[model samples]
Target: MTATSVGALLLCRADPEAVRPPAHLLRERMLLLPAGTGWSVLVPEGKPWRGEPHDGPDAAPAAPAAPGGAEPVDRVMGGWATALAVGATWPVIALWWDGDRSGYTLAAGFRRPVGYVWLADGTPAGEDEAMRTFAARLSLDPVLDVQELEALTRQDPEADADARLRELLAVLTRAGVALPPGLAPGEPADRLRTAAGVHPQVERIEWAGWRDAVQVELDAVESTGLGPWVRGPRARALAAAQVAAGIPLTLWGARRRGAGWLAAGLVLLVQGALGLAYDRFRAEAERGARGGGPVW
Candidate 1:
């Protein structure tokens, strides 16, 4: 009836697209297993899921498995990762073709079970009888039981949800990710700043903080070359104007105007070059973090 923490955590990945298996369905499947070690994953032989419009090789959902299909690589994936990723609702049984074949076995880390009918070798067996025994224990959720994902995705794209979504993304953006009104579609940022709005000062603070982060990121990019590509001419003009207005390098009389133009042009070019260098530097930094330094 109750799944352990890890089981629940992993199960939570299920999104509520009608085609995707519901969480309770997976739970019911797991409850049938007789206290065992090992985790679960999905695999496919020559065919795809029972009934599908597209029966092509990659059309049906399947999990990552070993050559002989014995050991599974990741536990988070069951049935087919593709199905879950695309929001299919079928309960995929992890099946292994057989041992002594040329492929390797998909093994698990012995994490808590969540209705995985172990694929001993590419075969789907009801040998794990506890699953059938607990079938009656499963209950269907009510319509109101819309999960968090459903709630998160329910609103119209151009509605408030999109705005909130933008702000949420804006909040989580890596420090230095810029957010001028140009990047986003609406003037919601300005509107949200008024004291009368439902979320007064919400977008205002977010925009302010976002701007600060953007500047830091820009400075880094300008020093290096990783700036974002913005579209609006107004935004670009504003940036250039800001550059031109700042203490101009003026000589005297006619030379003053020329000096301002020269200073602005140099600043613009320097800013652009820095952005290019930064993109390269940031990419390299990410690679180093993931690859654990150089190979050579």
Candidate 2:
């Protein structure tokens, strides 16, 4: 693929409605659209990786720097995938390609992300075990899907990086992923954004400040009947954990100026804060019901 074809797509194994709330927490402009039965695709409007180098104190020591200090496409997408999947039930698969390489990073829950890469010429550059892990995480057909994924890791003279990505998507079709027309792999980031913007069902996501974001998240949780998990000591402990994890992570991201980690840390902090607030609110309401006093 040409350098100009640098682009990435975040495929979430969830409906757009479920993906919207956490997506807003990313604080980046993106276009969301349904992919298939239970899949959604997020096309980022800005290419932050192409911008100024993240040399801040929070910058990740291992983050690879591209020419002019820009973060590599894979690194940026991988971070974003992790951010999106951290507190959500569904997994996020980030498919990214640049002039020199192409790969996919799959992040689910708090587990370590797993991925495989290929050179621009389609030579596999990752471990074979990664494919097995990928298939297992997605719950794809153990024998059939594993065989197909393994094929992508083998040498293929006719396939280029773009072709490899396409083949990977082909295997995912069985798991209900049908990308919209013109949203194909290897397209330029601007073009991908344009394509996503045109879809009739596309929804634009932007940073709307913490107040709005927290409200949306709370509404989502309530509507999804997740309130039970938002109250009680267990929930409070989880919130505390999130806050504890987020502080250091946010600090690290700030120091390094890494968007992915920053987003992740912010998400954790917000979610933790929300959890604490919700728990308190519910407790007061119950107390008021028992004639203790007004909740407010």
Candidate 3:
């Protein structure tokens, strides 16, 4: 019998803080950690089957249950990745594999998600349209990027899923994603954690339950470096503009079920609100200083 394992990595093109998912929002098996510059990776303890029927006699192991209904590992990974991408300003690439297949899905702003699939034996099982879309969204150089992607589809028949992922990574190197050493496809969660722990940039994130998770998120927001700009008139105007722009973008996304755009709109709204509030607080501090009150 062939041994089997399933794994996924969530690649983010922003600061680790931007990529950190709230612990309260995740099922038990998922852990988020920094991968490298402009990148974070989510490692699932196992599959995320969560109360669904298996495909057939050869189905992969069931994932830990969550509130939502169950789905296949690949679908679950795609949805999870899209949710993360939709919540932030940058794109997110979810790379996943089971014993029999491997694939990647890229989710970016307001656009339909794009992805490519490959059989375990390295056979191309994805649409060329997905490749074209992937390249276009990332602003990759057309000729070079397409050539590398096309080469993946034409790899030797004996090439396995691991090789396929490595090839994909090579193409993304130009996009400034350099995954830290020891983080790669096919590693067990335990080993992935151990490897991630030693890396200088990796910050391990575990579920701390709901209340604590909320507090953590709030604290992070407060510490962000918005003080200087928020206090300025021009910056305040920009903030107001963001608020103006966000509302319609958000509503449109909801009306159309556009997860990526919804996320971008929400981020804009939150940042704008924070900017306005920061201005108010800074003005109060300056007033207290002028009045010779406790300058806080």
Candidate 4:
């Protein structure tokens, strides 16, 4: 699948404390746009997918974070459809950060399929609709045939591919879904099977929320650095993410809620353009404060 299939895009923040959604707010539609059939699954690192630093693994699959802060590591998250057969070869995965996990690899049946972003049927159920529906009930765990997927994660020395079949069989048994061995995984074991749907795009939006919060915090640190004309580590990092996403920082600025203290956008107006004006304004204000100049 195209790297763009599972693209991770982000915009910069002006206020570190400001709240915003990572994905564009559905200003119009109340549904999640189907991303596409190219399945892009990501396993984020760090505590609960907070935006991590610049130099690190992109997909660190550690436990969720606690109240205390810690550095986040990276892990892999994107890929596309593969044949359902037993042995699959290396699939193509595009990379943005530095690491081997950023690319694709040869794995088992569930390594990553071309994701179909829609309701179970062929219809567009945007993030909002998905979330609304999932909030009550959604299908995510359909007794996956894990033998192939587990094989991708590690070596399996089983005599039969039936191990996966057994796992799925066990899950169905527990869910009270009775079916014959002849039934396919996708074929409904029962009428209620299709009732539950998975909303991946909604999950991605939540992930973006965590990132937005992180960016807002980073924005505060960078804003302070800007006044001194130094490149704060966080600012440099934000710029790098922009570059990777193939979007201009300026467009992200447009997504900010309110301007800076001076009503400047996400990144303040470049000092090159506003520095002298700022200094002159500061001088006049200082002079007036000292009662040594006209208060124009």
Model 3, span 1-296: residue lDDT tens: 12236666778777777656442355445555665566667666555543332343444555554566556556877887777677667888888776677789999866778888777778787777788788888788799988888877775876787788888888888877777777787764456656766766556565667654664564456457863454578668988999999999999899999999899899999989988887777578668868987534
Highest TM-score among the candidates is held by which one?
2
Off by over 4 Å in 3: 1-4, 21-24, 27-30, 45-47, 50-70, 207-217, 220-225, 228-296
Decoy 3 TM-score against native: 0.66
lDDT of 1 by residue, 1-296 (tens): 00110111111111122211222223222211101112112111112111111112322343344344332222233433323333332222222111111011111223222332222122222223333221212221223222321333333444342243243223223212232222231222222122112321111111224434444344443332223442124335544554454334322323656755666666665665444554456566557758888411
In candidate 4, position 137 carries an lDDT of 25
* Deviation of model 2 at 281, angstroms: 11
In candidate 2, list every pair of residues with a backbone clash: 56-255, 57-255, 57-256, 58-252, 58-255, 58-256, 59-255, 59-256
- Model 3 lDDT on a 0 to 1 scale: 0.71
Q: Count clashing residue pairs per candidate.
A: 38, 8, 3, 23
Per-model TM values vs. the true structure: 0.19, 0.71, 0.66, 0.17
Best by lDDT: 2
In model 4, the runs with Cα more than 4 Å from the true position are 1-33, 37-97, 103-142, 156-296
Residue-by-residue lDDT tens digits, candidate 2, 174-266: 999999998988898999999999999999999978866876776577666565567778789999999999999999999999999999999
Cα RMSD (angstroms) for every candidate in the order listed: 23.2, 14.6, 11.4, 22.9
